[model samples]
Target chain A: EAGVTQSPRYAVLQEGQAVSFWCDPISGHDTLYWYQQPRDQGPQLLVYFRDEAVIDNSQLPSDRFSAVRPKGTNSTLKIQSAKQGDTATYLCASSPGLGYSQNTLYFGAGTRLSVL
Target chain B: AQSVTQPDARVTVSEGASLQLRCKYSSSVTPYLFWYVQYPRQGLQLLLKYYSGDPVVQGVNGFEAEFSKSNSSFHLRKASVHWSDSAVYFCAVRNSGGSNAKLTFGKGTKLSVKS
Candidate 1:
């Protein structure tokens, strides 16, 4: 019963640099989501996928942010030309299904990103 | 659109004291509600959830939440608090009917237990 796993527990970069965060969801989970949590704030959804197909990404910054779940088991969220505003914790979560009662999300420790 | 609100930014309570955290939601229809707790340097963990039926639902660690449709609120409560219960509590909501339902979270309430 392994929980969701994320890589690079922390990251620091200068402005204009690029970085990517990876996530490995729990086995058999079909829904994967990426969220951004600013300091002292709740998580904001960035993008989500269900079985390799993106379900929603309206909040994603099209110019710099991108995400993909090629094989449906793992996902990667990238930020190009990072800025100071991008300094936040990048969280990854997954759920078993889309059912109203069963979609409880399980989250990872999150990658704390700092852009100077 | 759906949203959640946590009125209290922080709360302090003595050990063994009763606790209550306030939450309110705005949505066109009845939404699925949830409460999650986040410990230091840890991810969010589900405390409890309410989709329908009973207005009160029990969660892990002796936590419970009551849903009030008239007030559009779901408040977390505990009969007795413990020092270990100190953490940031977040209230969330998601539309009951949707294909790609996303949980909208509140700013969160930070609870401190004083021994």
Candidate 2:
């Protein structure tokens, strides 16, 4: 099976510019996640979905960030009026299901975003 | 709440030398544990996971990790490492039996293998 795919491996934007990232998870996977990883730091969860319904988005920056999984297979993460701190790699992951035994997540190469 | 801690920021080892990277987690119970490796400009790839039964589990590329319940630690070990094994290794933990899908990861340890 093909792994998760992310578009535009890298992006550079000026402050206050808008940017969007696209992700296509592996086929037949029911759960998808978006994470932000800064340089030299671990990934931090942004949002997640379970079959088109958001499971948790508490960590997401609601002011300028939004994510949607319209068909439950593909997702988009958008940042509005980008800030310098928004510079990071955005990663997408997918899993077969919930629970301990089924939660092995497969990740994509990630989209590196930079705001100047 | 759950968190992972990798005390070592970086480790240097020569080719064919034994290596060990430490990981400690904070959780009330023994949750699912995992070790992932990330090459430069690449995403994370699972090395191994621990759910139950075995304390020591083997992973891809001759990697293995031992889960210690008494110590709340899951340390990864490699008998002999090659230059290709040089990468950032992250230790992650997830609470067992949850629909949350939140995997807490440590800061990661960058391993450098010199020939």
Q: Name the top DockQ candidate.
A: 1
Q: Per-residue CA lDDT of candidate 1, range A1-110, in tens?
A: 99999998999999999999999999999899999999889999999998899999999999999999999999999999999999999999999884553469999999
Q: What tens-digit string does per-residue lDDT give for candidate 2 at B2-113?
A: 9999999999999999999999999866589999999999999999999999899999999999999999999999999999999999999988764667888899999999
lDDT tens readout by residue for model 1, B44-108: 99999999999999999999999999999999999999999999999999988767568899999
Top candidate, metric lDDT: 1
The CAPRI category of model 1 is high
In model 1, the clashing pairs are none
Q: Give lDDT per model, in order.
A: 0.94, 0.93
Indicate the docking level reached by candidate 2. medium
In order, the first chain's TM-score in every candidate is: 0.96, 0.96
In model 1, the Cα lDDT at residue B24 comes to 98
lDDT of 1 at A116: 98
